[model samples]
Target: MTTGLLIVQILNGLQFGILLFLVAAGLTLVFGVMDFINLAHGVQYMLGAYLAVTFVGLTGSFVLGLVLALAAALVFGLALEFLVFRHLYERDHLDQVLATFGLILLLNQGVKMIWGAAPLSVPLPAFLTGNVALMDGILYPTYRFALIGSGLAVGALLWFIVEKTRTGMLLRAGASNAPMVSALGVDIRKLFMIVFAFGTMLAGFAGAMAAPILSVEPGMGDTVLILAFVVIVIGGIGSIRGAFVAALIVGLVDTLGRSFMNDLLRLFMSAPSARATGAALSSMLIYLLMAVVLFVRPEGLLPARGRT
Candidate 1:
């Protein structure tokens, strides 16, 4: 590939990384802070996409649809917290996992029942159409550029909140030591509600952003959820900073490897053998990266509470 195309791939990798970070950010915090393992988090992502589809159909505006979808997701998350997740806070991780797994099944089936098994999507606004040339003869989609911009904006906002705000301070404390924070007389229940709702909103936002680019369907979140888990594990569980860094690493590695692995392998083997081997090798690259991270830093690069 030429230098220009390589630059575009790098840009593509960055954009993809930002998108992954958006989805994984909340997943990391929910597990890190509440000490709750939520497998159904993926369902939140799916619901966000579906809600956007429905709202766009009704209101016929992307901005209005986003507002409505976020509102619905916030409500749904709060309801789940009140009805189901609150009880799990005091329970063991195993129990939390089982309950959330059940939720995944229910939510997936519920989505199909309501929206049907066929895929759906909301259209991007006309303003987001077309592409801009960044370099000689190279153009990239406007929506993708917007995605990178929005994701970075959100990440910056999140960083500022976590680093500077009182609520962020409490959230960090909660993630570090929930029991200690509760002992300090803060309403831990309320704090959990805030965290849960915010995290759910982020995941939903990711889903909505992705709907225009990716196919909107039931179980779409499953693959991305697993990738998010891998991101957390590689970055260091419960650390937003770690999640961000890890996500970028995974995104670049996965994306670049897929595009270049065959070429790299062909140096050592014939084209047919390189194609077969490269495909498998490229697929394993992220997991291999995770394995190396674990071997070196078993607790992850940034453990939420500095606990190891």
Candidate 2:
């Protein structure tokens, strides 16, 4: 790839990573703090996109739609927590998985029934519709740059929350030892509810942000959910810092690999063989990285402090 092309691809990867971090951050927290295996998390992301599209169409304003979608997502998440997830918290992991999986099916079908089975699209705000000059000849999409900036801002905010706030301390402590935290008189249930709602909002926000770029359709969150899981695994469950680092790493590796793997492989193999091998290897890159990380530090690269 040319230098400019490479730069663009890198930027795309970073944007993708940012979205992944947003999704994974919540997933890790929910898993680590609550010890709840929620397979329906992906559907929450899908709900965000659907809500964004629906609200935007109704309001004729992207910003307003975003606000409404986030609020709705938070409310819906809290409701789910009360009606469903709250019951699963004290149950077996298998029960949690099964319950959440049922949610996935119900939500997916509901989306299709409400929005139709066809893909939907959201218009970019006029100002963000074009591209901006990155260098002498290179240009990047304004929306993507916005995504990267927003993601970074969110990441910084998250860092501050986890590192500087009392709630963050509780989160870390809860992840490390929930029983001990509960023993200290902290309302563990309240904490879980808050985390669950916040995580849902984050995932929804990610979906809203991504709606303009990716197809707004059923099951769109499935692929992203898998990536988020890989991110948490590599980052170390319950470690926001690890999720951030691993997310960027996975994004770069996956994006760059898909873009240039064939070219790199061509140096050592015939054209057809290289193309085929590159495609296969690129697809497996993140999983391979996960395996390597597990082999070296099974707990994760930056495991939460005090986690046994």
The C-alpha RMSD of each candidate to the native structure, in angstroms, is 1.1, 1.0
Clashing pairs in 1: none
Candidate 1's C-alpha runs over 4 A off are none
Query: What TM-score would candidate 2 get against the native?
Result: 0.98
RMSD of 1: 1.1
User: Each candidate: how many clashes?
Assistant: 0, 0
Error of 1 at 131 (Å): 0.1
Clashing pairs in 2: none
lDDT by residue for model 2 over 1-308, one digit each (tens)? 79999999999899999999999999998998999878888889999999999999999998999899999988998999999999998999889989998998899999999999999999997778899998998888999999899989988998998889999999988998999999999999999998899899989999999999999999998899999999999999888999999999999999999999999999999999999999999999999999999999999999988876
